[model samples]
Target: MTNRTFMTVEEVAAELDVSKSYAYKIVKQLNEELKKLGYLTVAGRVNTNYFRKKVCYSEV
Candidate 1:
């Protein structure tokens, strides 16, 4: 494993090869999904494990 618990928008952009704005959009979507599940989320940041689990099953 990794030491990371969360990822910033910039890191998400690089990891997904997306623009920062797009990354923010993606992060927002992730956060929304989490909120639907009763998880609290922070703006501009996402849980790394949660991202992996969601992205792994999606087109990304």
Candidate 2:
């Protein structure tokens, strides 16, 4: 990845090797969780670190 703090739906899809539609769903779900925690979220984008943690994508 490019060391960005956030990942767009496109980037998420590429990273997960999933379809863009599916990636949008994932982003929406994770954003909901973040909202519950009192964090503001951006539509069509997610925090990269949170994404890695949620999906169990350990650093290599």
Residue 34 lDDT, candidate 2, scale 0-100: 93
RMSD of 1: 3.4
What is the lDDT of every predicted structure here? 0.87, 0.94
Number of the top TM-score candidate = 2
lDDT of 2 by residue, 1-60 (tens): 899989999999999999999999999999999999999999999999899999888562
Q: What does candidate 1 score on TM?
A: 0.85
TM-score on alpha carbons, each prediction: 0.85, 0.92
Q: Looking at model 2, how many pairs of residues clash?
A: 0
User: Candidate 2 regions off by >4 Å?
Assistant: none
Cα-lDDT of candidate 1:
0.87
Which residue pairs show backbone clashes in model 2?
A: none
